[model samples]
Target: MTENTVESVRRALDLLRELNRQRVSSVRHLHHATGLPKPTIVRMLDTFAALGYVVNDRRQGGYQVTSLVRSLSAGFHGDPLVVEAARPWAIAFTRKFQWPVAVAVLDRDAVAVRFSTIPDSPVSPFHVTINNRLKLMSRALGRAYIAFCPPNERNLLLRMLAMSDDPEDEAARDRDAALTLLAMVRRAGFADRSATVEPKSSSTIAVPVMLGRKVLATVGVTYFTSAIPKAEAIARYVPLLKEMAKNIQTSVVLLEQGGAPNDGAH
Candidate 1:
């Protein structure tokens, strides 16, 4: 491709990615998210709409992607970009430490595990499937994300959690306590849960994966509480977990910059 053609393709992909992230986004939102000029974004969105890859919603005052975009990943695996980026490192960490690790991202009011090494971990005693969802206010993964995410996003997530009907989300209703917990997580630079959300014998330490000032996801390591004390676990495993998280963040950023293969390349 010519130089201008390559640049155009990159910009188009960036716009498409921003749309995918937001689901429904206005030109202003696209401009902000992709750092593209408003006129350029409008033109690209119009082109995408004409090509049936996106739909312009006059009523909603935004643009939404169409199923045509799914064709781009028709043969792809289920994991998202962050999961793909973190998979090798997560598995390696588990292999080295004999402790299962999970990579999770915020999904609405809860955190969703996008990648996990538990099932395949060499040392995992139980043959258990990964839990896809965890409460935002009570789980280490969720708290790590909430604590590290930008203030506007953290506030929005808190509001969503507070509106949840689940009794466990009552912590979201206690603004002071919730804030205090998040403050601690931020100060400590990691979140810990001991027999709170998991089995009595299990505990977890989670840290956020950051891209710039924004948290892209959380990486966590889980172990049997009886096997390792909380202080020892924090001291021994937290650095490794944070390192893996940082590496994953770097991989994701490079992938976003077109340094790696597309999600479906696998």
Candidate 2:
């Protein structure tokens, strides 16, 4: 609205802000949210799609922001590459399995959910989980991250958690027992969400996204306990989730090198 400010630029930013606010958006929603004209919003969304910052996914029900927006948005501080690498694969996994997939990265004493496919999942356990921070020992995503990261880094994280008062980090108090529990996760090749977390009727299984033993992030799928037995969910979903994590790793490398991701990873 300023005399020197370009109207188009301001409008575009407004559109982008609205797009980023919603997990998925359409022209109608953008217009309603930003008070922008429908035609203008459509044009901007099309431009975003052509520029690879937005993807129109019918299954997800609208145009969703792609990881390319990480540079444009200053909210999330985790590794953008990991989020970029996991976005498509996570969506694919959710679409195929009908169970929501989430990607998280280490954030201080905990792991933060950076991306989730709940919008694509018809049977998602939670309405939305993005930005939810999970403890490094109790939640599946957090346990996978700490259990798979290097020993030095894990120890540092544990020490940090030990000094914290968050109830979720209570497991860090018993270092010996905590290490023993994490050792089991390492051996089991995945982490299962502790039954103590909210929504006890639902559980998550997570695996680390590793590039040569250096964990880039964690990916998980949540399912209802009543719908699937513990043994069946673990036996069937674990392998696929692990494979998706590996595919994300490969895609991360490729993306960093300015190449298209390997889409045949399913």
Candidate 3:
């Protein structure tokens, strides 16, 4: 496609994202937010709706997002490196902890979960989904990645997220919390997420997958709050979590060495 065609598609997608942020928005409001012509905005919305990517409210004269975006997400989640690098940790972590485990990567300001394994848990509820982006500030794994990311890159990620057209103050707070957690991780060598799901029954522990000083991704274990008591969660798993972090680091180093010559270390 021509450059103009690509740019048009991008702008249309941006319009859709903006509509999603407003909960619902009218064509005139979209024209105001995006500076696109009202007729063009209406046409794009109609096209998007026909494709099941968006839905309109006749009463409100507004539109909202649908599940079609997730169909696109399925392709991105299938990337080889993301799959190859994360799947082993997912399997190994679940086997060891008897809890849910996930491997995730930072996608701009979002956390993209490539895969997750849910353990049988009678006590705690499972809420996370594969291919879903977690709230960057609220999730332990996302925070761990942000905490260990190199200073410049981390700062850039934060700034870009802050200035995004779909800016989220909650996401910024999460980044701050992640920074705080990173500092604690540096000193203590592991990160924990307690009472994240229910006041009584869910928690998590996360570790960064580092390549030298850079953070490549994160691995985490989650449990129903009741399945593992708070004290036991830390006592039994923290050390093993650290071990997994070390192994991930070593693996990164090996992968770097095995890459085509002159590919700079991550």
Candidate 4:
């Protein structure tokens, strides 16, 4: 390939990496994240969509990488590094507490569940999976992430949240309320969501998994509201949840340093 072709290929790979990181992004978001021109982002997105590696999301008005991109890792047997790091701890936490757990990372303006133990939890009341996206200001996982992330990242996320298409995620548009909520979360060192964002019978508590000053993800435990009172749940599980988060973070660091084996299945 010519020099120009090599440069184009590198740019395309960079765009793909940004898309994977953000999950769904508009041309503007891609430009901001990758420092590429808007026209280049648009052209690359159009090409990716035509190639069936990306899709236009009408509901959110953004471009999302499609399952076709998984072919790039066809021989990979494990989850993403972070998810691989959390899988064992998540399962162990569920088995010990008899409550379902989920680990999520920021995907654009939402928290996307990268790992969930709901389906495997022996005591989980709901057999269904918990892989759905959570609104940034309304769910415990998202609130934990937004509250503990670095200030600049938090501000950027808040701006993106404010542009949410869902009317129910109005908390994002309410800057004052969102800030107040985040302040409360910071002070509490964790976040909770009740029937307001979830079913009336269920609730969740979440803590951030930190790597230095950055929040790698948020880990959460869910239980039936009637089965466990909020205060009791907090008293019983918060410390354990925080410890698990630390362990997951340590494992991720170890994996990064090549000091541990990655044995978990994706």
Best by lDDT: 2
Clashes of 1: 0
Q: Clashing residue pairs, candidate 1?
A: none
Task: Count clashes in each candidate, considering only residues at least 3 apart in sequence or on different chains.
Answer: 0, 0, 3, 0
All candidates: TM-score: 0.66, 0.70, 0.57, 0.67
lDDT of each: 0.81, 0.87, 0.67, 0.83
Name the lDDT value of residue 28 in candidate 3: 76
lDDT of 2 by residue, 25-93 (tens): 767777787898888888888998999999998887788889898777688565578898799999998
Highest TM-score model number: 2
Residue 167's C-alpha lDDT in candidate 2? 87
Worst 10 residues of 4 by lDDT: 122-131
lDDT for 16 in candidate 4 is 86
Stretches of model 1 off by over 4 angstroms after superposition: 1-78, 126-131, 194-196, 260-266
Superposed on all Cα atoms, the candidates' RMSDs to the truth, in angstroms, are 16.6, 7.5, 11.1, 12.6
lDDT of 1 by residue, 1-266 (tens): 56556888899997887676544678887887789899899899889989999998779568988989979878968767888899999988977887888889888888888777765565554323344687777778888988889989988888888888887687899888888889988999899762445566777899999988888889998888788888999999988988998889878887888866455654
Better of 1 and 3 by lDDT: 1
